[model samples]
Target: MPDLRFQSQPPAHTEIPRPKRAEGQWSLGYTEPLNKNEQSKKDDDALNVRDRILYTYSKRGFASIDPADLRGRFRWMGLYTQRAPGFDGGKTAMLEEEELDDEYFMLRVRSDGRLLSHEAVRALGTIGVDFARDTADVTDRENIQYHWIRIEDVPEIWERLDAAGLSSLEACGDSPRPFLGSPVAGVAKDEIIDGTPALEEIFDRFIGDPAFSNFPRKFKTALTGHPSHDVSPETNDVSFVGTVHPEHGPGFDCWVGGGLSTNPRLAEKMGVWIPLDEVADVWSAVASVFRDYGYRRLRSRARLKFLVADWGIEKFREVVEKEYLGRELVSCDSPPSPTGHRDHIGVHEQKDGKFYVGVAPVAGRVSGSLLVELADTIEEYGVAGARLTPYQKIVLVGVDADRVEDLVTRLDEIGLSARPSQWRRNTMACTGIEFCKLAIVDTKERARDLVTELEKRFPDLDTPITVNVNGCPNACARTQIADIGLKGQLVMHEGEQVEGFQVHLGGATGLQANFGRKLRAHKVTSAGLDDYITAVVGNYLVDRQDAESFATWVARAEEELLRGEKALTPS
Candidate 1:
C-alpha cells in the first residue's frame, strides 16, 4: 500500500509561522519547464510590460513582436486577438489555445460612467467605421469594444483616441481597470452629490501611472453619488456609494472586496464615511493596499476578495488604515438603500429641466454607422451630450422637451429604441464563442433570438425580469444577479457536441440582493432554449400572485415546478 499521508499533517519543524511576504511580492510559475536556452529569458519575463512596449513593440511592429509580448504584454495596453472578419461559427470552445487566436485585434476604449464629449463620441464612431469593420459594442463596463484592429495601426489609433481625450491605456490589465460610475452622475435629479470630479481626479492621477501599473490580478473600482447606486457598487473590488452623513451632510460610504466570476461575493460595508474631497485619496489608498499586499502566488486566488475574505473586514480595514492611509477613517452612516429602479431607461426629466432619453441597443450591440447617425441626430436635436450606462444602454442628456420627440424618432430610425419591450430591455449577453476565447457556446445572437421570440410571444406582458446569458462561467454578463441566468457549457446531444446552458433562477440586486440558485439537473440545449424559457416564464405567469416579481416567484416556487421537466430537452 502507498504511504498516503495527507499534506495537511506537516512535519513538526515546518509548522512555524510563515515568513512575511515583502511588499509587491508575487511569484508566477511558467506554464512549462524551460530548457537551458529558454531559461535565459527568465530575466526578460521578470520585467514589466512597459519596458517591452518601449523597446520591443514600438520598434519592431507586428512582424518582429515577441510571442510573450503578443499574447500577454499587449493586454497591458488594451489589445487582444480578435476573431477575424467573416469567421463563421466554428471552434466554439477554445480547447486549444491557438484555435481561437487571430492576427486581428480587439481594442477596448475605457469610458468611465459613459462620460464622453460629443466630439469624443463622434470620433469613436469614425474610428469604428475606419478600423473595426463598422462593428462596435457598448460593454457592460460602460466602455466600448471595437474589433478587427491590426497591430500596425496601433499608434495611429492611440493618436486619434488621444485627440478625443480618451485612452485605452491600462484598460484591460492586471492594474486597476476603468472606474465605473453612474451615467447621470452630475445631472441626475436624485443624486446625492456630483461624483464626476472625484472620478475624473482619480482617473487623471492614477491611470497609466507606472507605480500602480502592475498588480497580482485585475482591480476594479466604482464610484457613484447616485442615490440608486447606479454603478452596482456591491459587485466591484472598491466602491464608494452615495450616502447622507447626518452631521457632515453629503458623503460616500465605503464598500470593499465585492467581485463576480467563479466565486461571487457581495461587498461588505467598511463603516467609514468618506468626504467628497478625500474620496480620490482614499481610492488611491485602497488600490495601494491591493498592489502591495494582494496575493500573487497563484492567479486564481490573487483577487483582493480572497485577501479580504481571509482577513475579514476588520483586519483588512486595520491594514488599509495603518499601512496605506496612515489615518483613521471617520465612522459614518450606512449607504442609502436603493430606491426603485436604477436602470435609467426611457425618457426622464433631468435636474436642469432638460429631458434625458435612455435607450437600449439590443444587448449592447451597435454598428459604427448607427453610432454616426446617433451623433448626427443628437447634434441636430441640439442635445447636450450622451452617456453610456452600466445596463448596456445609452442616455442622451440635455435634450429639451421639444426636441425629445424628434430625438426619439431619430433613435428609432437608427434601431436604438427608448421604448423597447421588456424582454429586449432586460435581456443581456456576454461576448460569447463569437469572439471570446474562454466561451463554450454562442451568446449575443442567441440572446437576441431568444428576446425577439419572447417579445413576439408575450407582447403585452408587463412583468419585470432580467435574463442574463454568459458565454462561460466567468459571469461577465452578471448571470448570477438575473432572474434567469444561463451559464454556457458544451454537452453531448444526439452523438454530437452541442451548446447547452445550466440555468440559475431568482438572482437579483438592490435591497433583495442575492445570487440565483442553480437548477438541479436542468441543462437546456441551445436548440431547445426558446421552448424551455417560454414554459418556465409561462408557468411563472400562471402561478405568480399579484404583481409578484419573477425573482420572488422563483424563490418561493418549488424546484420541480420551476424546472418544468416537460419543457427542458435532454442534452
Candidate 2:
C-alpha cells in the first residue's frame, strides 16, 4: 500500500433553491445569502466521494489517495485513517494535523437499528480478525469499529460484509449514521410496540439512497417502543418514542433536535402521535427538512439540533406537517418517565416465554475473536437473534430456559459478563488518543483503570452511577448525561505535561434529564484519577441521605465538598 498524497482543494460552491416563507410563522426559509464555506459545503456533492473511492483510490492503492478524500470523501464509504499505534501524549497536541493519518484505517460498519443476525455477526468477526488485526470496538452509537485496515483490502471487506447482509455505507460522513432502536425491540415484555417493521422500512427506503447522501453535517435517528426510554430519545436528532393514546392503543410520540458535543441540548417533544405505519414517512420528512433547510454555513453548527433549537419544536412541527406530511398529526398522551437503568444488563424474561441475556463489555472494547465466540454460542442455542444496545452492551435474544445457564457460563468465560458489577456495567469510554486523531488524552485504558479502582475502594456502593469518559469535548461517550462525566485534556503536573480530565457532576436522564454541570477549577491527572474519584464517591456515600442517587447528591452538595481536598494538587 502506497502513501498517496491527494491535493486538497476547497469544496465547490453552489446555490440551493430557496423555500417560500410562511406568513406569521417561522420556517426553515433561506432568508440570508450563503457564505463561501456554506456554499462550498452545500454545492459539493457527497455522492461523488463514493465513485472516487471505488474507482480511483481502490485501483491505485493507498499512495494515490488524496488528503481531501482522506478526511471528507473516505467517510462516505465509512473509512477513517486511524492514528498509528505508538504515538503517545494525545494525537491532537503531539503531531501536526496532516500527520495524524497513518497507513491504517478504522472501518465503521453500520449495524442499522443495532440489528444483527448470526451470519452477519460471524462475518463481521472474520473481517475484524483477517483484515483489522483483531481490532474491534462497539461504539456507543451501536456501530462496529475495525482498525488496522489498508486501502487495498477495503473492496474485499465490503464484499464480505455485503454477502452477510451488512453495509458500511452512510455509516459516517454528513449522511445518517447507524439508526438506534431498542436492543429488545421485538422481545421485550414491557414494550408498547415492536418497532422493527418501522426500522426496517426506514432502512430499506432511505439508507444508502443518493437522495439523502448529502447533509449539512451528520444526522442521528432513534426509534424505540420500550417504556424505559431505552433508545435515548432526547439525545438524538430525530426520535420516535413509544406512547399509548387513549383512543389509539399504541403509537409513537415525535421528538426533534437533540444532540451533544461542545454545545449540548435535549430533544424537544412535538406533542404529536404518529401511528406505526407513518413512522418511516415522518423519519424521511425530518431528514429531508434537515438536508434542505439545515444550516450549511458553519460546519460546527450544522447538526439538525441547531435548526430545531432555533425554530422551536412547535414551528418545526408545523413545517414538517404542512410542507412534508400534508396532514395534521394527532395529539396524544405522553409516555411515562423512564425508570431504573435501561441498559438491559443481566438476564430477563422476554414476552415470547424465552429469555434475553444482556452482557456488558468493559468500556465497550471487545476482540474480533471474542465476537466469533459469541456468534458460535448464538448458533448453538439456535436462537432467534441478538442485538447491540446503546449502553455499549449486547443482548442475546430468544434463549430458552434450558439453555440460559449454559449460555451464561460460556459468556462469563469469554469476558462478556451477564451479571457484571456496577463498575463493569455502567462504565462507558470513548476511543481516545490511541485511535482518534482529535482526542486529547487516552480514554479507554484510563476508564478501565478508574472502574477498577472505584470498585476496589467502594465495594459496598449500592447507588447506581454512570461513569462516562470521553477523549474530547465531542461527547462520544455521552459524558453530558453521565452521573460523573470525565472530559479528557492535557494538564501540567509538577511542571510537566500529563493526561488529565475535567469533571462534570450531576447529570441525570429520564423525567429530569439535564446536562452535567462542569466543576470549576477541578482537574485531575490520570495517575491520580482513581484516588480523586474514590474520595468523591466516598464523600457521597457518607453524606447522601436515605439512598439518595449520586446525581441528586452532587446537585445539592457544596462545591468545596464535591471537589474534595485531595484534588487541589493532583500529582
Candidate 3:
C-alpha cells in the first residue's frame, strides 16, 4: 500500500444553528456532503482494483467472492495490510501492517470518534475482518471502541465517520481528546445545570485547534455539575467540576494531575474556583501551560501528573495561576463540597417530570447494531438525546412519563434492561490481553463471569459493591478507586503457571481519595474465578459494619483475615 499524505485540514468555522423551538438549546447536524472530486480522488488513491473492490464491499458488506478467493485477495494485500479474523496466530504480524497494535486500534477508535458507526462496522465485516465486539469494550470515559480493524478500512472508515459526526481530530498521538462529561450531565434532577453545552463547546474548540491537537502528551478533561462522583474528575489531567461559590457564581472547580496511565496519580487542585463565564479561558490557559511545560522527552513521563509531581502542587498551581490570571494567585473564597456517591445505575427521576433510565452493560461493550437500536429507541421514546455514563451505562433522558413502562419493556427486548439486584451492575473492567497487549489478563471476560457467580451466591445482596478489574496496572477500569480492585498478573500455583489477579481494597473516589491497598492474591482458572470472588464478597458482607461500603470494609480488614477469606475453598 502506498503511503499517502492527506493534507492536514483546518476546521471550518460555522455558526451552530439553534433549534427553531428552543431558546438556549442547539441541535447538532452533519449534512454537508464531501466534494465529488475529493471523493473520486480518494477512491483513485486506494492502491489497485482489489483494494477498491474490498473497500466498497466493506462499506456495503459481502463481496462477490468465495472464502478461498477472499483469502487470496487478503494475501495479495500482504500480511501488513490484511485484517486477520481472530485472536489466533500472527495477530501482531497483521497489526504490523498498519503500524499499530489491535489495542491501539481500539484506543484510536475511541480517541478518533469513529468506533461505533454503521458504516465503520460494515466495512470491517466486508474484508473478513473478524473484529470482536467483546474485545472492543467501552472505557469509563464514555467512549465506545472496536478492536482489530484492517489497514484498508482506515481511510474509508474515516471518510464515512466524517459524514456521521465522528471526527478523528485528536484521538491519538499526544493531544487533548474528547471532553469527558457525565453520562447524565444535563438530565439529572440534582444537577445545578447541564454541563454538556460547555463540554461540547470545549470539545469543539480543542479537537481541531492546532495548539491543542498535538500537545506534548495526551491530555484528559472531564466536566460534571452533578454532585455525584460519577465522572471521576479526580483522575483526569484537567478536570472542571461544578460547584456553587457566592462570588464566583456557579462554575467549575479545576483540578490537575489526575490520570490512570503508566504512573497513576490523583489530580490536585490548581484553580480555587473558576466562574462559569471564565471556564473557556481557564481551560485554554491550562492547555497552554501543559503544552508549553509538559515533558515530551519520555513517553512514560509525559503526562501532566508527572509535571505536577516534579514541581509539586504549589508550583504547578503557581504556573497555571500566573498564566491564567496574568498575576499572582489568590486564595479560594470557598472550599468545595464533599464528593458524593457513585450510583449512576438504577431508575431516577429527572428534574423534568420525566425519568432517566440507567442500564448497566455487563462491560462497557456496545456494538454498532446496539448503537443503532439505541438511537432508534431514543427517537421513539425520548424527548432529548441518549446520554452515556462513565460507568459503561446508558441513560435514556427525557422519556415521557406515560411511555416509561413501554420504553423499559423495549429495552429488555433489546437485552439492555436495568436490574436492581444484578451484581454485574456494579462491576467494571477494562479491555485486557485479548485486545490490548498491555493487559496481562482477560479483564472483561473475568469481570463478567465474576459478576454472574456473585449474583447466584448472594441473590439479594443490596449494598452497592464496585468491583473493578484492569488487565494491567494502567488502571483503565479505575481499579485503584474501586471497592475491590483487581490488577492483572501471572501467578505460579504448584509449579504451574496460570493467569491470576492481585486484589486491592479500600479505594475510594472522593475528596479524600485513596488508592486501594493490595490484599490477597488469588489464583484460579478463568472458569472458576467467579466462585473465588463470591467467597471474598461473602466474607465482607458478614464482617462489615452497618452502612460501611465495600471499600471501607476492605480498608478495615486485617491482611491475615483477607488472605484467609481468599484462600477459602469454593463451595
Q: lDDT for each of the candidates? A: 0.78, 0.81, 0.59
Ranking the candidates on TM-score from highest down gives 2, 1, 3
Q: Lowest-lDDT window of 10 residues in candidate 3?
A: 24-33
Per-candidate count of clashing residue pairs (backbone under 3 Å): 0, 4, 6
Task: Pick the lDDT winner.
Answer: 2
lDDT of 3 by residue, 474-534 (tens): 7888888877777777667778656777777667778647887764344444555676666
> Over the stretch 1-571, how does candidate 2's per-residue lDDT look in tens digits?
1111112312213233343532111123543334543343344555577677767788898889877677676787888888766676544775775687788898998776655778878888899899999988888888889999988788889899889888888888888888898999988899999888998899898877767876768989898999998878889999999999888888999989999999999998887788999999899778877876787666777888887877778778876776667677898757877744499888999888999999999999997898898889889887676788888889888899899999999999989999888888899999898888888889988888877878787776676788999988899898989988999988889998898988888887787688887877879888888877787887777778887888888889878767877333332
How would the candidate models be sorted by lDDT, starting from the highest?
2, 1, 3
Which candidate would rank higher by TM-score, 1 or 3? 1
Per-residue lDDT of model 1, residues 1-571, tens digit only: 1112222322322111233642223212222213321222232432366556555665676667766666665776788876543433435443454556777788888888655667888888988998889989988888888888777667777788989888888788676787788888777888898888888888888887666766667899998888888888888999998888778888888899988899999888898888888998888777876765576555677688987887788887776676556677888867756632477888999898988888998889997778888888878888888888777889888889888888898899889999999988888898887777777788999999999999988898887788899989989999888899999987668898678898989887778788998876778888989888888888888878888888888889877767776443323
Where is model 1 poorest over a 10-residue stretch in terms of lDDT?
A: 1-10
Instruction: Return the TM-score for each candidate structure.
Output: 0.90, 0.91, 0.76
lDDT of 2 at 276: 95
